[model samples]
Target: MTTLSLHWPAYRLFPYERLLAIAEAIALLSSRQIAEDPESVTVTADRPAAAPRLTYFSAYQTPRTPPAPTVQHLIESETSGGSRRQSTRYSVHGLHEYKGKFNPQTARALLNAAGLPKHALVLDPFCGSGTTLIECAHSGFRAVGTDINPLAITIANAKAQALRCDPELLVAEAEAAFRAAGRSRRGRLLADVRGAYLHRWFDAPMLARLETLRAHIVERDPSVSEILLVIVSNLLREFSLQEPDDLRIRRRKSPPSERDPYQAFLEDTRALAANVRVVQRHTGVCNATSVRAHQGDMRTFATAAAARGMISNFDAAITSPPYAMALPYIDTQRLSLVWLGLVDPGTLPSLQAELIGSREFNGSPRSIWERKLVDNSERLPAAHAALCQRLLEMLGEQDGFRRQAVPSLLYRYLAGMRDSFLSVRSLLRPGAPFFLIVGHNHTVLGGHRIDMDTPALLSTLGETAGFVTERREPLQTYQRYGLHQKNAICREELLTLRAV
Candidate 1:
C-alpha cells in the first residue's frame, strides 16, 4: 500500500482542480483503494512504486520541507503565493502576457491524468501562446501546436525555444542585443505607408527606439533572436498611444507618461532569462526542435501537417477554445502584429474574420453566413441549431446590427468548431483523449439574457465528428481583477472526449 500526499496548494484549489488532482494521482500511482483526507490522499495497492512525478502533489510519502525556492518561485511567490495554478511566472510562459491562456498547472495535471508515455506526441490545435506545449515539454513529451494567429505562433515558438536553448547563451545574447539597440542612433523615420500607420500610435522617439531594438534583434544569432523579439513585442502596448488596459483598440484620453523602453526591455529580458534558468533546472534542457508551432487555421491544420510529413497520430490533445463571440484577438494585438511585420495592416480585418468565433464579420461574408444559417446548410446538431433559431427569434427590429448578427455568429462559431473537431480527430489515434476547457457565456437579445452552454454544445459537435463524449465536469472560474471583470466568464467546464 502506498499513500501519496498532495502539496499544500492542492488543498486550497478550487473544486474542479481538487478533482483533477486526485484523478491525476490515481492514474500515475495505479492505486486500488483511494482515500482522501484534508491534507492527503492514501491509495492501497499490492506494492509501492517509485515516487511518481506529480503536478499538484509532493512525491514523497512523508511530509518534508519544500525544496529551496528558486528565482522563478521567488518571483511568482511575490504576486500569487507561487501556487501551482498561479505559477505562470516560471519558465517562458511569463515571457509575454497572453489573454485567455489557460493555467499551466491545469494543463500539466490533465497530461498526468492522461497517463501518456514519455516521448508521446501531444497536439493542441488551438494552441494560444503554447501553454499545453510548454507543459508537454516539461513532462518529456514532444508537442506540435497550431494556431491561426501568427503572433500566437511566434510567442509559442519563442517560449518553446527558450526551454531548449542554453540558458547562459540566451542571457548573453539578450544583453548584447539590448546594448546594440541602446547604442544605435535614432534615424529619420521612413516616409512609407507603414510608417504613417505606426505614427498614429507611437511618438517618434519611442518608435525609433523600438525599430532600433528590432534591427539589433534580427542581427543576433537566429537561434535566440526570436526570444529577444518577443521581449520587445511584450513592451509594445505600454509604449503605444493605445489604452493598455482595454481589450479593444482605444486611444488613451491623455498620452501615456514618458516611459523608458530600454529599461523595460532590460527588466523583462533579465526576468525571462532567470525564469528560463529555473525551468532548465527542473526539466533539464528540452529539445526545442521537437516542439513545433504552426501558423494556420485549426480547421485545416491536420491536412497541412500531413502534407508536410508531420506526425498525424498524436497520443492526446488538449486546448481551451475561444468562446462564442470571443474577444477581439487581432484587434487587441494589432500594434504588435504590425510592428513585428507579421501581417499587413490592411489585412487585419480579414485575418480577424478568419479566426473561429470571431465577431468581425460584415458585408458579404456576414450575409453569406446568415443565409447558410437560414438554410441549415452546416448540418448542426439539433439542440445547437434550435438555440440559434431561438436567439434569432428573440431579436427585435429595435436591436442593433451586432444583436441582429448574433444567431449567424453563433452558427458560424459552431460550424467552425465542428470542422475543427473533425480536423483534430483526424490527427489523433483511435481512442486517444481530447480535452477542452471552455467557458459558458451569455448574450442579451431583445432585452432578454440568453445563456450559451458552449461546453455542452461542443460535446455534441464532438460526438458528431467521430468522438465519444466521456465527461463534462463543471469548473469554477477565477475572478477577473481589472477592466475586463464585467466581461468575465462565471462558469467553465472541462469536456473530455475520446476519438472514435
Candidate 2:
C-alpha cells in the first residue's frame, strides 16, 4: 500500500492545532485499497526531524477494491500543499467575505480528531458564515447551525444548497439573471433602501444596477433567488466606494470609478459555479449527511431546540464565538444587510444590543449594575473576574459615553457568554466533545492591564456547566506592539471540552 506522510512548519499548523487531519487524509486516500480488517492510521505530532511530522503510519492489505474515478481525481488533486488547501476549496466558501470566520481546515481537522461515527449530528450554535456546518456536511456528518443574523443564515443556506445544484445550470441561470437585470431600465429606488447609507457607499448608476438585480432575483424560485442574492451581496463590498481595509466597516475619502456590474456578476458566478462543480465531484460520498441552519439567537437556541425535541442528541459541536468587542459583525456587513432589506436602518441599535460582545447597550441605567450582572460576574474565572473588577473601576475614572458604556458592555458580554455556554452544554449528549476555536482581547482599565483570557475563562466556565476541559492547545501567537504591548501577547487557542 502507498503511504503518505509529511512534515509542516509550525506557523502553518496554527489555529486548528491538531495533526489528526493528516491521518484522515490518508484514510480517505487509502479507503478502497484496504482488505479484511480496516486498519487505522497513526497521526503523530512530533518534531522527529527538521519540522513537526504529521506521520500517517499504517499497515494494511491492499487491492481489495479498485480506486474509483472520483477517488483517482481527488488523489491526483493532493499535492505537497494539498493538506493546507483541501478544506477551503474556494468554492461556495468564496460566496461571501465574513470577518472572524474560522478556517474550514480547522473545522475539518477538528472533525477528524473528534472520533465520531459517520452521519453523526454536529452542532455549531455560533455558526458564523457556517464554516463548521459546511465542513461537517462535506465530511458525512449531519450538522445543525444557528445564527441571530438573518443575512448570515441566508449566506449559509445558499452555500449548503450549492452542494445539490447542477454546476452548468448554475452558470447558465446566473448569466441569464444578470443579463435580464441589466436590460431592465425600470430601476427605481426601492422603499426599503437605506437611502443615506446607500448613497454614501454606492454611486447612483451602480445602485440602480443592484436594485435591478435585486428585483430580478426576487422573482425567481426561492432557492435560486437566495443563491443569486448571496452572489449579488458578495459583489456589493467588492465594488463599494470603500477602501479594502480591515473588517470593520469604513468608507473611502472619494467615490470609486464605476465598472460594469453585469460583467462583474457574470464573472463571479461562472468562477463560483466551476468551483462548486469540482467540489461536487469530490464530495459524492458525503451526500447523505443532512445540514440544517436556523436564524435565531444562540443564547436561547437550546430552549427552542428542546421545545422542538431537537436537543441532547448531537454527538459533537464546533464553533468560534465572536471575540470580546473585537469585531462588530452586524456593522461590518451593513452594506449587504441594508441592500438586501434583511435589516432596517432604524432597528440597528436594537439588533446590535442583542448581540454578544456588542458595544451598544439600550437597557436602563439602574439595570446595568443590578443583581443579574453581579451573578454573571460571580460565574467568571479568576482572570475574568479581575478583568471585570478593573473595568468596573474604570467607570469612576471617566465621564460621558466611554464611562457609561464600558462597564455595561463588559458585564453584558460576560453574561451573554455564560448563557451561551449553558445553552450549548444542554444540547450536547453526555461525554460528547465540543471544540471551541477562540481568541482573546486586551484592554486597559483603571490603569491596570486586563487580559481577556478567553480560552482559560471558557474552561473555567465550562466546568460550571457540567463540562470537563480535556485539552487546551495554543495555535498562533500574536505580539502586540502599540500602546498596550505590556499585556498584549494573545494566542488563539483550541479548547476541547467533554459534556458530563
Candidate 3:
C-alpha cells in the first residue's frame, strides 16, 4: 500500500512531454499502477522505495505530504520561464549558445526511461553542444560524445569541465583574465589568413579587443582557459559584422562598439559562473574524468575508440542527429570557430561540406557524392532509395542548383546516417536502447512541396544497420522566435530503437 505521487509542470504544453513524464515514472519506480490527475500522477507500488530520480516531475510526495521539489525543478526555478524554454539552458548548458541542440530535460527523461544502472556508460555520437553529455553527468552516468564541429567539441568539454572545477576559482580566474586583457595592448595580431578574415568581419577597435582577450585566455591554465574561451566565443557574433539572428553569414547593418566586447564578456562570465554555482549546489560535483568528447566523424568514432583503448561497448545510446539539408552550422559559428582557433579560415568550405547532412557541397565533391550514392544505393533502405529517385525525377530544367541537388544530398545524408547507425551499434551492448529526437522537414521543388519524414527514414536505416525499431512518438515543438521561426520545424519525432 505504498503510494508515490509525481507532480509535473501544471502547464504541460506538449502531449509528448506528458507521455515522457509518465514513462519515466513508470520505468524508474517500477510502479504497479499509475493514476493520473491534472497536476500529478499517483503511482502505487507493492513496497516502499526511496524517492525516484526523475526528470519531468517538478516534485513528488508520499502519504499525502507536501511535494518535494526535484533538482530539475530547483535549477529551472532560477531562471524566468525556465520550466518551458529555458529548461535546457540551465547550469553550464547555457555557457555557450549553440543552435539545434535538443532539450536537456528531454534527454534526462529518455535516460530515466531507459532504466540504466547507476554510473552506466552512455554514448552520444553526435553530441552537438553536449546536451546529452551534461544531462548524463548530472544523473551520475558516464558518457562519451563525438562531434565533427570543432567549436562543438570545445564548448562541450568546457561545460563538462566547469561542473568539475571549483566555481569560485573559475570566476576569479576569469576576472583576472579580463582585467589582464583590458590592461594589455593588442599583443600579436593573428597573422595571414585568419587575421585577414577577422579584419573583414570586425571593425579595427573591436577586433583588437577580441584579440587581446584571446591572448589572455590562451595564457591561462588549460582547464581555466577552456572555460574562458567559451565565454568569449559566445560574444563573437554580437561583436562581429555577422547578423546574429540569421543562421547564414549575413552581414549586420550596424556593428557593435569596441567597449561592447569587454562589457559582454564580463556580464556573460558573471552570469555563467552564477549558473554553475547554482547547479553545483543542487547536483554536487560531477566526476570530470567520466565525460569525454572527441572532435571527429561519428561514422568512424567506434573504430577510433577501439584503437584508443576507450570503452567500446556502452549500456545505451541517445542522440538528436542532424536533419536533412540541416542548417549552416559552420556558417553560423564561423566567427567563433576562427576566433577560437579551432579551424582555419581557408578550409571552412571543405569542412562545412564534410559535415553529415550539410547543404554546402558543390563542384567535384558534389559529383563524387552523387556517384557514391549511385554505386551504393543498395546500402540504403528500399523506401529511402526510392524516395531519392522520385525526387530526382521530379526535378525540372527550370529548377536551380540547390533544388536539383536535393536528391543527391538526401541520398548522401541517408548513407551517412546508415554508417553512423552501424558505428553506434558497434559501441552498444546487445539489446541496448537507442533514442533519437529528430524533426521532419519539407522543401518546394518543381512547383511541388515534398515532405521529408526523416524519423521514419532513419528508423528504416537503423533497422538495416542492426537495430529493432520499437516505436516512434510524435512531439509537438514549442514556438520559436526570431528570423528563423518561419523556417522552424513545427513538429519532431522521438524514435526508439533497440540495438540487436
Candidate 4:
C-alpha cells in the first residue's frame, strides 16, 4: 500500500470585514452598487456551527482492494484527438446580470492530464453544470465527463469548446422554426392549454415562445445543440414573468411582454458569443476538445466515461457534490428538463444522486434543526424557542426565503451531498487525490446538529471505499480577494483524498 499526505496550514478564515470590503471594491471597479446591509449579504458575524476547528480525524481501516477492481473494467473507452494550451485570464466584463457573484476571470479548475501524477482523463461526474470541464479542456487534458441533465452537458460542452458544437448553425435553425410557427400572427392561433404544471409555470405567450425554441432545437444542428439549449435553459427562467429568477411556479405575476423564442434565441446567441469572448480573454486559451460532456447519471458514469474511450483511470478530480436533499435538481429542474427534452418523467428520477434527495428522504421535517437546537441552544439557547429562521440563514445569506419552505429544503440538501460524493469516488483513480469544495449550513435534524465537515466525512467514507485520509484545506468563501464569496457564501473546505 502507498500513502502520501500534504497540508496547507496557511489557509485561514476570511476576515469577514476584509472580505466585504474587497467585495465592495470589486463592485466599485465594475460600477455596481455594493450593499452594506448584513441581511442583504450572505455573510454575517455569526459563528459557524460548533465543531472542532477540525479537531478529529479518521483513517482508512479496510484492507486495500486490489489495485484495480474487475468492476472498474465495466467502463468502455473510445479515443478522440484534441490538444490543449492554457491561455491567460480571459475577460469581456460587465456583460451579464449574475456575474456579480464572483470575478468570472480566473481559472482555478485542475485536471489529471494538466499536471497530476497517476490519474489522467478526469471525470467530474457531479459536474454541476460543467465549471470543471471548461477548465480541463483549456488546461489541455483529455477530459471525459457526464451529467444526467442534458442541458448541463450542453452548457459544459459549449463552454469546454467541444469541437462538435456549432452555435451559429443552431441560431439559424431557431430563426427558421419561429418563422414556420408564424409567430408574427399573434392571434387565437396560439393555444397553451395542456400540462397543468406548464400552464402554471409559463403564461400563454411565454409557452408559445418556449415551443418555438424547442422546435428549433429539434431541427437544428445537434452539434451546437448545447449552445441553443443554454439559451433555452436560461430563457425558461429568464422569460418568466416571475422574479426573472424565481422558481415557485405557484407565485409571481406574469411578465408584461413575454419573450419571443426567436428573439430569445438571438439574445442567447449574443450572450453566448460574448460570454466566450470573456472566457477567452480571461483564461487566454480556447480548448473545447478537452471537454467531453454527456447527459447521463452519476451512478452510471463509470460506464458512460468508458464509452467515451476513457479508461477507469483519472488523475486528480475536483468538484462539489449536491448535498443530501438540498436541491432535488432532477425534480426542481423537471420543467426545464422536459421542455428541453433532457429527460422523460419515467427515467428522470434516476439521474439524481441516489442517497440524497431520493424519494426516500426518511426524516422528520425538523429533525436536523431539532438537533441543532439542542446543540446550539447553549450558544443562543434562546433560538431554541422553536423560532423560524430565514432560509437564507440556512441556504446562504442570499437565498433566504420565508419560513414554511425550510424543512423540506434542508432535508433534500443533505441527501444531495451524501449521494453525490459517493458517486464521485467510483470514477477516481486508485491512490489519486480528489478535492472538493463544500460548505457548512444551518439546520437541525433528529435532535442533532447536521453540520458536516466534508473532508472529515469523505475521509471516513473514502476509507470504506478503499481510500486513505489525505488532507483537508478550508477557506472562508466570504474572502474578498479570491473566489466567489458572496451572500454569506460561508467557507468551502478543499478536501484532498487519495484512492488507496
Candidate 5:
C-alpha cells in the first residue's frame, strides 16, 4: 500500500477511509501525531499558547491533564471490530436513555474535525436527544439544536440544564423532589384518564403512585421538575411489563428487575446528579447558556430562527437524521409521553403522524408516489437520478400495503432531508461544514429487499441544494450495534458537506 502525507480537516474522514480502494501511491493518512523538533519553535511569540488538543476517547480536558489519544488511536478503536462499548454514564449524557442516539465520542470527534474557531456557534438541525449540542457546549462552542419531537427537546434541554447546575445543588433539588413525591397522597386525580395500554402495562396502584409523583413534579417549576420527571420516566420501562432491549410493549411473564419503582427513581436521580459532577471535572462547565433547543420542524427552521432572533452565521453542525421508514420514535417514547402528560391516547395517533420516519399511512398513498417522482428528480446527479428511478420502478412492482405506502414514506423522508439541508445552508456561513451521521434503512419492494444507500443519495441531494459533498466515512458503532438487529443497516456514514 502507498502512503501520502498531507494536511486537511482531520475529523472529516473516518477510520473507514483506510478501507477505501484508492489508486496506488495515493493512500490517505489518518494520523494526527505530528513529529516535533525541540529546537524548532512550533509556538510563536505573536500567537497565544495553543489550546489543548484532544485525544481519542479522552474526556478529561484540562491543561495539566494527560495528553489526548492520537487520531490513529481513535481509528484503531473504531476498526477494532466488536460492539463499540464506551461508558455512557458520563455527566448529563446518562440522564435519560435516548433510543437511536449516536455516541458522544463520535460527536466530539466530528466537532474537532470541523476546524471551527473557538467560541464559534454550531447548529444541529435534527438534534435527536441533543448529543451534538452537548458536545458543542462541552467543547466550549455555542450550540443551537432543533427537533420536531418535543420529547427530544425536553430531554436535550434537561440534560443541558443538568450540566450547568452545581452538582450539590442538583442533588439537593432531586432529593427535595423525591421527598415531595413520597409524601404526595394519591386519589382519583387520574381516574378519568382512559387508556387500555396503560392499564395493561402498569398495575393500577403502581400507575396511580407514578401519576401522583408526576403531578407533583410537573406542578413545580419546569427547570428542576423536568429533570426529576425524566428520572421518573427512565424508571417506567423497568417498572412496566415491557422488555428492556426492544421498544415493543410486550408483557413479560415477570418483571425485568425486582427493585421498587420509587426507590429506583430516587437512586437514578442521585446517579444522574453524580454524573453531572464527573462531567464538570472532565469538561469544564459551560458558563454561557447559549444552547437553545427548539421543538420545531427542520423544513421550517428558517422561520423559527427568525422569530427567535437567532443568528444565521453558524460555523458548523453535526447531526444524525432518523433512518427512512425506520423506528417509530413517537410511539416508542409513548411511556414518557403519557407519564409527562404531554398527550393522552387520543392525541397519540396525531402526534405519530407528524414524525418524519413514520411507517403508518395517515395521508393519501398517491401523494407519496407523486412526491418521489417529482421532488426527488430536481438537482439529480446522474447516478443518484438513476438510483431514484430504479427505486421508483421497484415501487411500481410492489404489492399490498408496501405498494401503497413505501413510496410515500421514502418521499416524505427524502423531501424533509433535502429541505433540511437547504434550511441549514441558509443558517450556515459560506464554507461552514455540516456533518451528518446517518444510517440507511432497508425497504422491501416487489418481494425483494434492497439496501437504500442513504448517505450517497443524501449527498447527491445536498449537492443539489448547493452544498459541496466533502467526505463520507463509515461509523463502527453501527456495524457493532446492527450486528444482531434485523434491520438493513450495514454501517452508518459520517457524510460531510460544506455550505457553498
Candidate 6:
C-alpha cells in the first residue's frame, strides 16, 4: 500500500480543509498509532479545546458512561479471519448528525464543517426528516434526498425547499388550507374524522385546524403546499393524544378533543415561517435542488423510475439505509401517509420484509420481534439476516404466509442499496468520499446473533462497485429508544465509509 500525507487547504485540492485535518488523523492507513509532536502538528491558537464527545445512543442499553475508542483501537480489533466470528460492541461519538428526525446538532455540525464546491451535488438517500437536504440547502449546496416512504419524501421537499421561500406566503397558505378544511367538515369537530388512526390520536379541535392546513397544502401555492405537508408531518403526534413522543402507544378508542386546532395550526405555521427565515439569515441559502420526492421502492432500481435522471450524477453520497427490523415507517406514520393519500389505509402491511428481528414498539414493554429474535438462541448470524427473517415472517403471517416476497424484498433492498452505492461511485470524482451511515440490526434468528457492521459486509460491495472503505466510524447508541425490546440491538452501527 502507498501512503502520502499533505496538509489540507494548503493543497487546494479539496474544500473541507478544516475537517480534513481531523479526518486524516482518524483515517490513518496503517495499523500502527501515530501521535503528533507539538512541532509536527499545527494547533490552532484561537480554537477552543476540543469538545468532549457526546453520547449519541440512549434509552435502550444500560448506560455506562461512554469510553473513548480511538481509530487505531478500532482497526487493531478488527477480526482478520473467522474460524468463528466473535461478538463485540463499539462506541464512537459526535459523528455527523443523523439526517432529520431526532438528531439536529450533529446534522448542523456536519453542514457547518462541509466546504464542498459551490452547488456541488450532495445526496442523502436515507434522508429522515430531510435534515441533510435541509442543511444542504442552508449551506448553499445543491442536494438530493430519497426515501422509501412517501410521507418522508413529502416532509423533505417541504422543509428543504421552504427554507428558501417567502414565509408570509407559507403562513397565508396554511391559513387558507385550514379554512377550506373547516368548510368541508361543515362545522363538525376534527374528531368526527373518518380515518381510524387520525381519530384515535388527534384532538377534535387540533384535527379541525390541521385539516385546514392539509387542505391548504393540497390546494395552494406551489411553495407552501409542500411546506404545509411538512408542518403536519411533524405535528401529527402533538395534535394526536399519544402520550410521550412515541406513536405506537395505543391510542384512545376515541379522543374527546380539546385545543383550538385553527389556533394551533396558525401558531405552528407562523413559527415555522419565522424559523425558515432565521435559518436563511443564519447560514445563508442552502444549494439544494427543487426537491425530488419519489414514492417507489428503492429496491426496484430494476425499474426505470429508479434510474438516475437530469440530476443523475452525484458528487458525494451520504446515506443511512433503514435499520434492520426497525422503523416500520409505513405503519408508524400511517395517519399522515393516509391523510396525504401517500399510502392506502385498507391495504395494511403494505411494507413487510425479511426483517427477522423487526418488531414494533409495544405500548407497555417487550417486543413482538424479540420472540423471533431469540428463536435460535444457540447460534447467531449477522444482524441483517436476522432482521430480514423477522420481516419475511411478518409478511408471511399477513398474506396466508406468503414466502417469496420477503426474500425478493430482501434481495431488492440489498441490491437496491448496492446499486445506489454503485451509482454513487459513478457520480463521484475519483477519490471523492461517499460517507454512508448505516444501522446494524441485531436480533436472534435461528438462535444466533448477526452483526452486519456496514464496513465488513460492504467490503465486497465496495470492491464490486469500484470503491473502498476508507475509514470507519463505529456504531453506538443513538437513542436507548429500543432498550427494553429487541434487547439485541442495544448499539446502532454508524460509519463513514469513504470511497477508494
Give candidate 5's whole-model lDDT: 0.66
lDDT of 4 by residue, 414-452 (tens): 333434445556666666667655555544433335454
Give TM per candidate: 0.91, 0.81, 0.93, 0.59, 0.80, 0.61
lDDT of 5 at 24: 8
**For candidate 6, lDDT tens digit of each residue in 138-218?**
445677676666666777666656666777888878778766775675433443324555666666656666665565567
- Residue-level lDDT of model 2, residues 309-380, one tens digit each, is 875688998999866665566776788888887888777767776788876665545355434445554456
Q: Give me the displacement of residue 203 in model 6, in angstroms.
A: 7.9
Write down the lDDT of every candidate, Cα atoms only. Answer: 0.80, 0.66, 0.82, 0.45, 0.66, 0.47
Which tens-of-lDDT digit does each residue in 213-255 have in candidate 5? 7766666655577778877887887777667556665666664
Candidate 1 clashing pairs, residues 3+ apart or interchain: none
Off by over 4 Å in 1: 32-34, 45-52, 62-85, 254-258, 362-364, 478-490
Write the candidate numbers in order of decreasing lDDT: 3, 1, 2, 5, 6, 4
- Any idea how many clashes model 6 has? 52
- Candidate 1 lDDT, tens digit per residue, 1-500? 54444443422456677788777766766765356666666665332352345666543353334433322233344444345445655677888778899888799889988978778999999998999998888778899999999999999999998888777777788788778777777644646666767889988887887887787878888888988888889989899898987998998776685768877887787777777776676657777688888898988888887899978989999999988999888898988888888988888898988899899884447788878887788999878888888887899878998889899999999999999999999999998999999998899999988888899899999999999999998886555223333343447899999999
Which residues of candidate 3, in runs, are more than 4 Å off? 46-52, 79-86, 185-188, 254-259, 362-364, 372-378, 478-490
Q: Model 5: runs farther than 4 Å from truth?
A: 1-85, 184-188, 192-197, 219-222, 253-256, 364-389, 395-398, 477-490
Lowest summed lDDT across 10 adjacent residues in model 2 is found at 50-59
TM-score of 1: 0.91
User: Which candidate do you rate higher for TM-score, 3 or 5?
Assistant: 3
User: Which segments of candidate 2 are over 4 A away from where they belong?
Assistant: 1-89, 193-197, 244-246, 254-258, 285-289, 364-367, 370-387, 394-400, 477-490
Q: Backbone clashes in each candidate structure, one number apiece?
A: 0, 0, 0, 60, 3, 52
Q: Quote the positional error of residue 49 for candidate 1 in Å.
A: 5.7
Top-lDDT candidate index: 3
Candidate 6, superposed: residue stretches over 4 Å from native? 1-115, 175-185, 188-213, 216-220, 240-244, 247-249, 253-258, 285-293, 300-309, 352-416, 446-455, 475-494, 498-500
Screening candidate 2 with a backbone cut-off below 3 angstroms (N, C-alpha, C), the clashing residue pairs are none
RMSD score of candidate 6 (Å) = 13.2
